[model samples]
Target: MPYSPEDKKRAVMRLRRIKGQAAALERAVEEGTDCKSLLQQIAALRGAANGLMAEVLDSHLRELFGSAKETVAVREARDPDEEIEALMKTLRTYLK
Candidate 1:
């Protein structure tokens, strides 16, 4: 589903933060920062990215099946099994 302007703004903010974190991570590795500090930054970045993913997934599910209404024609065109399996694969890859 396409995001509303507000949602798009929020997601963009998240992505920017993640980008900054990634750059910092690269610098840390290149400069051979202390192991503990590097691990902490890495963990924090991973958690932030995961949270963003969770929000996107939740929003999409809600739009498709929860409070928000989707077009019946569009909904009917999709196979439930295929959709479920696709979501499962995406979740697996995201979590992995």
Candidate 2:
């Protein structure tokens, strides 16, 4: 999906938080932190990863389903001469 700048920023922030959580988890593991503490960290990290995955999957699905409308709008807005030229270019490419 082509995300807006704000959406991209939010996604980056989410991933950054997830990365921090992962780093903390790694530290806990190396230091032999209590099992319960490790488990909690694992759960939190998994949740964050799942949330990000869901968001990205949703965006991908939206792009797949929504692009038809976007394509139509673009085609409708194009100048006739431009459209003809585009079509000619496509034909030339296909023929080659």
Error of 2 at 78 (Å): 20
lDDT of 2 at 87: 53
Off by over 4 Å in 2: 67-96
lDDT of 2: 0.75
| CA lDDT, every model vs. true structure | 0.82, 0.75
37-60 per-residue lDDT for model 2 (tens digits): 999999999888877766776675
lDDT of 1 by residue, 1-96 (tens): 337888888888888999999999999999999999999999989988987887799877766453536668877877889778877887788677
Error of 1 at 4 (Å): 0.9
- Per TM-score, the best of the predicted structures is 1
Worst 10 residues of 1 by lDDT: 62-71
State TM-scores per candidate.
Answer: 0.73, 0.66
Candidate with the greatest lDDT versus the true structure: 1
Give the total clashing residue pairs for model 2. 0
Considering only N, C-alpha and C atoms within 3 Å, which residue pairs clash in candidate 2? none
Q: RMSD (Cα, Å) of candidate 2?
A: 10.8
